[model samples]
Target: MFEDAFKLKIRPDGLEKAAARTYVTAVRDVLEKIHRTACGKALLQSIRFHGYVVNIIPYPGADVCGADVDGDYDAATGIVMPTVRYTPGNFAKGGSCSHLPGRGWAESILFHELVHALRDIAQGKRRVYKGVVMTGGLHRYDTFEEFIAVLCEDIYVSERGNPHRLLGDHRGIAPLDPALADSFRFFATGSQTFRFVERFCRENPGFTKMLSRVPARFNPIAAYYKDPRKAQSFSNSPAAHERDADGVWGKLFERERSPTLPTGSPANLPPPRPASTPIRRP
Candidate 1:
């Protein structure tokens, strides 16, 4: 079972067989570790993304690149396939995640593809989108989905800050790392964003009343991650001003200003990234 799980049989020209085996082993090790505990669910979900494979054929003018997931779900096999490509050059020989020896981007690509698979399983064809499963396609996620991936990456990075891994460096791109943080920045950001939108809708209910006409797109989950005060049209009224002065909406207000909250499991991680990103290798 383990062998089947970690297998990487596709061979690329100018790529070493030994290094390829090692990369497969590393991926298997991470998956095996995650599978042993309750935390394995996320990692396991990613395996279903194992689908069509491709090699990164290098061109002289090309820049370093990695695998991309094309979101087409294999209805027959129930798997989402990602095409893993490697750069052709000395970089490939370096074994860096950005290079051939590096499987960092591969891991992230796999995980991201799996997310599409999971979404399909949960929401069915109703929520399916296109172009997310192929190489370079994972970057096209919707705003909320992007947030989810970012937050997960933040948590993974903070928990497993290994020196040899090049993944989960979402700090610079987003104020709050998507991976769960010790301070829970992502949660706080999301919560604030949610409250803001919810309160805005209440104030001018008609402005977005049409949103309720359709159920799926205007989900509460999207609102759950926003700040009430930041709603586009929200303004401080006399009553709202008084409440703010009196701190009546203490919890709500606090969410925007570092609201204290519970912690999450330590094992959560973000999808891996290319070495070009600011991630330390583990």
Candidate 2:
């Protein structure tokens, strides 16, 4: 089912075709390994149950190495990824590859998006944390959602045996605060990983300060949820909802607690969507 859910295709150009095949093979190996892990199995089950398909397309000369359209989880539909042309040079410069060795950059980004897809289904439209809302929108790079996704990507990389590479990909998008960067490095390297996130947020004023600087346009819940009536309709109170979101994160961090896999067998899972036809751009 995991294999069927993720489909990769490239534009017909010779270079892109070769790159796509290489990336697809690498990504498949990573996903297969993930399927064997306790937390990964839960994520796969959630993605399958939600009927989410990940369609990846590799395009030449793209500015960003990879990007997904909005509404990835809206109504539980799948995600669309139009990736940048995969070249060793581009991968190295893309920032996601900084901490990864060889092809691990591709694997890390793929896993990062997979983490987003899993959280999209788990958190739904109304998830609110510490007054930051995610209703009717996606998470910004600086949000807790991204934090969790990055953390998951790091955990995956660590489990693959290069624990030192944790958050190398994230440094590009994360704030440039030396303290914050050091903190992430410490968390990635430390024994008490998840506990550090909880503690750091409490102890570090910089965390909230950096979050406050994120442009309002990047935050979906900022405008709509600010209205007292709208906020109340979503939850009893902001504090309560924040705690609920924390609980969800706690479960995601724990490998032993698996959300019951959606009912029915693999055959009942939805088939992969037809591949997107590539169009030649001048």
Candidate 3:
């Protein structure tokens, strides 16, 4: 492990020597894939690597191959990445996901978890976007956080391509319901990861909750928003994802009447949104 340059610790927990080695190697490969572009590097820098830990424990009953825990506020403390092969999900030892920039299942899953960690970072109290601080709010669950994370996972796959679900790429983008097609189309297809998130805040308006509603209210400084819902943080409830009158997601959710629809990019559609101003943390 000393020779590996990935900063975070990969705690094999109780795995034998060979299993532990595999986990360590997976760390190296994920870091390589994540550093392949400038946007990927932004994702890495947003979630600083110090004190981050990757645990090798299976989330069997949970049906997940990987997971992330909410940090005290600004960052997630660590991530759970199972070393055991998840064949049902087509994630196996040394197997690669059938997606763009195609890479190992471990890399794909870890990248997704890293997005979760990044979300926690973005929702921090002191993060001023445009001008005002992004405090006291939660981009909670299936509607908000997962929206960015999955879109991000696909964009990470596409690099610079529009992340709209393409033919045969069912694993990631395929699962979204029809109404979200436009949401994904509008957000993911336009910008790379960093701008996608920054614009999401601007476009969606109040998708993130009020700072007064969260723990950040008490100790505004040095405090970031945190999720207390445990594994259910992905829950997309009316409260957690209240549709704002002028918010983009609000408009997207209004089309709920459309039943299950297949994922496909139409020949004629809206062009990519103009590039937003550069985003920076204060």
Best by TM-score: 3
Task: Rank candidates by lDDT, best first.
Answer: 2, 3, 1
Misplaced by over 4 Å in model 1 are: 3-23, 33-38, 45-65, 73-93, 96-113, 120-127, 130-142, 161-185, 188-282
**TM-score: the better of candidates 2 and 3:** 3
lDDT of 2 at 248: 47
Question: Comparing candidate 1 with candidate 3, which one achieves the higher lDDT?
Answer: 3
lDDT of 3 by residue, 1-282 (tens): 431343344555556898767765655555676566444565555444333432333233332333444344323433322222222132444332233232344444556666655454444432422322211111112244454555455444444343333211112223333332332222222122223354454532332222113221111111112322221222233322332222344234324422432343111112322222110000
Per-residue lDDT of 166-233 in model 1, one digit per residue for the tens?
22222222232223222212223322333433543453243223322222221232233343333322
Which residue pairs show collisions in model 2? none
The lDDT for every candidate, in the order shown, is 0.33, 0.40, 0.36
lDDT by residue for model 2 (160-191), tens: 55423445223243222232233222232222
Which prediction has the highest lDDT against the true structure?
2
lDDT of 2 at 82: 22
Cα displacement (Å) at residue 143, model 2: 1.2
TM-scores for the candidates: 0.40, 0.42, 0.44
Ranking by TM-score: 3, 2, 1
